[model samples]
Target: MSGRLQMALSSNMAGESRNLGNGHNTNAASPLKIFGHAKSKIRQVFKNIDEYVTESDRFLSGVPAEERIVDAMQIENVKAYRGKIRGIIDVLNRDHMKVAFFGRTSNGKSTVINAMLRDKILPSGIGHTTICFVCVEGTDEPEGYLLQEGSDDRKQIGDVQKLGSALSSTKASEDSMIRINWPKDKCNLLKDDVILVDSPGIDVHPNTDVWIDKFCMDADVFVLVSNAESTLMQTEKNFFHKVSERLSKPNIFILNNRWDASASEPEYAEQVKRQHLERDIDFLANELKVCSKTEAEDRVFFVSAKEALISRSPHTSTPTSVLAEGYQARLFEFADFERKFEECISKSAVKTKFEQHTVRGKSISSELMAVLDNVFERAIHMKAEKYSTRKEHADKLDYVDRQLDMMTKDIKSKIYEMTEEVERTVSSALNEEIRRLSLLVDEFDRPFLPDRVNMDNYKKGLHAYVEKSLGRNLQSRCSKALTITVEEESRQMTEKMVALLPEEQKQNTLNFLPRRDFEIAYKLDCRNLCADFHEDLEFRFSYGITALVNRFMGPKQASMILGRGFVQNIPRSMPMTPQTPTNEAHRTMGSDDNEVLLALLATFSSLYSRTTVGALAVTGLVAKAAGWRILALSGAIYGLLYLYERLLWTNKAKERKFKHQYVKYASSKLKLIVDLTGANCSHQVQQELSTTFTQLCQQVDLSKADLQEEIKKLNKEIGKLEEIGAQSKSLRNKASYIDSELNSFILTYLKQKD
Candidate 1:
């Protein structure tokens, strides 16, 4: 952001940019043609690496190839790095720069590209026309290619004008791209170092925002077109506000286009133009954060893209065609805008791209050097041990194999031991807690034993209360204990696996075998144990309680049990017909005297039922008249009737005996509930124990390949290893020397740029 745009449309002068900190200058003075010097160094580095790669491949191609000793995949990664280095060199030679045109709909972005190219390539119309990003690159020849995203092949095109239909349409389609191979001389701006892109309007399509940020992130310069007939609209400001997150403000150019449209009101054209220009500059500096008012003025340009585009006429010496009077003067602004764009972008393009390529090259060089150094270290390790005879080599192999088998056995034992320890810890805790739960059953039975209560309601209420109590205790004691035990035991297993064998022996086996890292095999699978424990405990308790409740109570009775409504009558589902006496007590109680007394009581109860008070008064008078004997008989009669009604019993059973049955039945039911709860908790413990044991078996696996077959190969390969190891060490030293030199040269070249 500086006032470097002085004398635009006048001369091809190179404006100086502010010096970047860290002793680097944007306008550095170099006697060696910057591109020529860079290209020479780049070619030299590529040749050196290619030679090193060829030598490395030759080493890998020998008998008992490097693939058998080390991972073959590593060589492929190095090859990929080499391919990337060549790609950077190609890009450096082409030096293609990006310049993107962005603004709201119909603000004349395509028109700007058309005028710059001096050709009507982009489709511009009343509504949105250029719907996707059209990247018009400068090719060595006058040709074009269309490549839709995901398409493997590019189709040849004869004209840039044909790109519009393929890019933008209402029909659903994948992303489309157009690469115009414009002859370098088609435009002065695209002559040496830049490619221009005409993007869709800022807010026209939802996907436009994504493609611009993701696909066009590499664009070096951005030109925002505004209608100069008026000041910057709020829509344009809001659009740029979102755009500013991805693009820097210093790289933006504010073009106040259509400045010539004011010729209709020619009375005070200069004043109106000045007013619009000043207003736009202020907005750019304040809202867009364009550094300062001076910088904004330097960047803003007043231009008529339509006039500039149409001014070209085949008949005239001066470039002007069908346009309003005074349009040519307005066209001067467009000329000035082009000059400013070159000053802003073209001047910096070479230096910016050079720095990028240098940094990328340095990184690749450092990575390649590191890889070679690692390979050299591996070779040195192999060369350290040597055998004068085949018998000595066989002895060493036997000793190594025996040590690996011992190490594997110890690891398996450690895993089993951990599983047993955790299982014991939980099982012991579960038993102690279950016995304690049994002691609470007596208190639970109190609700179910209540007289004058609804059997249904009491059963339901007690079931919920007891279930909640048991659930809390199990979660706090059983689940918490199990979780803590499993986690600690798991941690121990992990530690043991991490230090499973002597570090060197494990490493030797890893270098030979496919199992590389020990820690990778020891992943803990107890991530959801705590959650599973809580869910299982709750679900099992609820299931057990439902079964216990169904055995003791009916629907209606159970509902009223908790309401303190005791058994009022026998269950309605049972048969109500009276049976012939079978027991001794019932037969004696139902003899002829008892039958006569029951009939007498039934008749008196029927007569007195409707008129109880009157009947009582008459009985009292009769007792007084007949004397103490008649009164005593009447009192005994009334006592027997009252006892039968209250107890809902025949003459065979007493109320005291019936109350005892309630207590006995309720206690039995409470015992059953406690038993079921304990059983469920025990099952859960077993489940969690099994899970932990299985996880340990998986994590601390001791499985290995049969070494007998490998031992046979070992005899054949051991004799040749010593000879190969000696040659490998010698070649590795040469590779190291070349890598070190490449790193040194890369560092020096980048340091000069810094």
Candidate 2:
């Protein structure tokens, strides 16, 4: 076992010491101590950023799926950044200044580390002892312990013997690491957050790249332990070259150990020392390009680890006065290497380790801020669009309401006018039908015989015929006006309503509208109303004057004028002799008959021209009842004359008078109910048109209600987005503040002051 590197007695007394590590005080203005403080501050910054990322992730997750501006993949990417930040935080928490040693076998790499530690912490011999990487760091515990890679169990080391035994018994790979945590009381370098890594000889390992990547990637300084008797070897130089390739401008120190062996070759010692020094300087400044020549000169040192260990050990009995040649100079050179290494490792560690983390923190904050800004802008745009859409819906609703009101007023006025027009049309048509009643009655071709049954049936047929003719004329004329007006108004209303409805609902609403193809009926009960009419079938003597005189002289004075109660019960099958009457009445009746005949002829000239007026000559009963020749001949002659005269008078006077009175009665009744029928027709039109328009109004109301509901929902969403935007903005400001603080701290501590 080797001892520690000895310090000058006066150098030790220059500063007050504490119990932290190797009696080093916290007040010491050391580079490594400043690096520790920088690491802690940078770690805190990373933690702050990590917290912000977590809050951002929660904010993104809480947003509704449709409203979320950031997609799921983007949120996942943010979460990945959080994971990376957390990994960085873990790294920063355990961060320390590290120095790794690389050299060939039996070059005293372990002895050099042991010398610096002021104790035999690592096994060193002529044979290969370190099979793998061994990292030694300081612990607060009084006793030291060993922790292997991938193992949670701790192997306690009370002394060097136990440490060596525990390291030998472990079956580990070349790339694996065994961590040896020693007490801070034993070593000042370890106490000040320095981790010294010892590796297998570079000669024994071909995997230089992997070795460097795993152990030397974060190493702040590298020490090349070489034989002072020999020049720098190819293997030692190649390892450092690869390290320089991996790490940008790595801090490297050259320690030429066992320089005391040079005492045997004193004559060539000065030349060899100069050769080693120049080559080492060339390797660092020229070949590796890691440092300048002036800087490399201070890095190169020749020392004997054995002598320095002996001088610094408290267990050794040998004194410095009896030591080998140039022992004091070697010890002083070893001490110089330590002092320079302290400064180099501290500065390199601060720049290499904490600077990169600070940059990443700033980048994360900037990216998240940009993402938040995009989200805020998107929310604002969405709110603006919603407002615009709501205004459009509200405007449309107002337009529909105004159009509906105007349509309702116009349609009502049109319906009232149409009702009046229909009533007038029906009245005019009825009056024209009554005036042509004789012609209309003549058109009834049903048999009218002298029997009571035939006369009664004939009266019924005539009543139906006249009633149907007048009703058909009125309906044909008036229905056109009602149908056209109602249909046109309904179509206009339907079109207006369809425009107000949504496109998807328009087809359904059209199907829901009522069809206006119903038939209009006018109830004119002609048969029941004309039941009192009597057909005058009695034989009359006078063919013209006497019959007209009896027709004008009705039972009552008012009956003739009013055309009511004019006809009395006459014998259906009996013939009556002509009654001789006053000449004055005959003259009066003749004057009236002449006027009536003229009017009937003017109205029904074409109707009579189209008819064949047949006359009965004789009856079989009159001829057969008297079998004697003269009697039969006389009776037949009288019957034929009476029948002929009666037929002529019936056609020209009795029938015409009967038709005139019936026409007057029917016309009066139909006229009395014309207003009612017109009213009914108008009401039907109004009801159909009003119902369709009302349903359309209902559809418009429903559409407006739906639009209002959507507007309300949009308003709520906008409010929520506004709140979220405010929160995101606040979080962005906090992130920016933390990022700025981290940059400031990095600039303050990472600068090289010593």
Quick one: best TM-score, which candidate? 2
Candidate 2 local lDDT, residue 570: 36
Query: lDDT of all predictions, in order shown?
Result: 0.54, 0.73
- Give the per-residue Cα lDDT of candidate 1 at 336: 57
Q: For model 1, how does the per-residue alpha-carbon lDDT over 1-754 read when each residue is reduced to its tens digit?
A: 1132234323223433211111111352322233344456556665665565555555543425442453466567666766776676677666655787888778888888877776666677666666566777666666545554455566564333444543443421324555555656555445545688877776566665666666567766678887776667776677666667666753678787776777787787768767876877777787777558876777777777777767642222444545667664555556556656665664344456655655565565555555544553444344334223444545555665565466557645754554455445444544454455444434554333323354445445544544456455545655655556545644554444434333554445334433211110111111221112111101112222233333444444334432332223323363376555568547755674554543444344344444778578657767778987878886787677656555564322332332333334434443434434444444444454445444434333332122334445554455445445555555556556655655555465545444
* Model 2 agreement with the true structure over 212-259: per-residue lDDT tens digits: 888888888899999987889998988888888888888899999899
Candidate that scores best on lDDT:
2
Cα TM-score per model: 0.42, 0.50
Off by over 4 Å in 1: 1-6, 9-80, 83-95, 125-128, 142-179, 188-193, 206-208, 248-250, 262-284, 290-294, 310-332, 346-357, 367-754
Candidate 2 worst ten-residue window by lDDT = 16-25
User: RMSD to native for every prediction?
Assistant: 24.1, 23.2
Candidate 1 positional error at 197, Å: 1.8
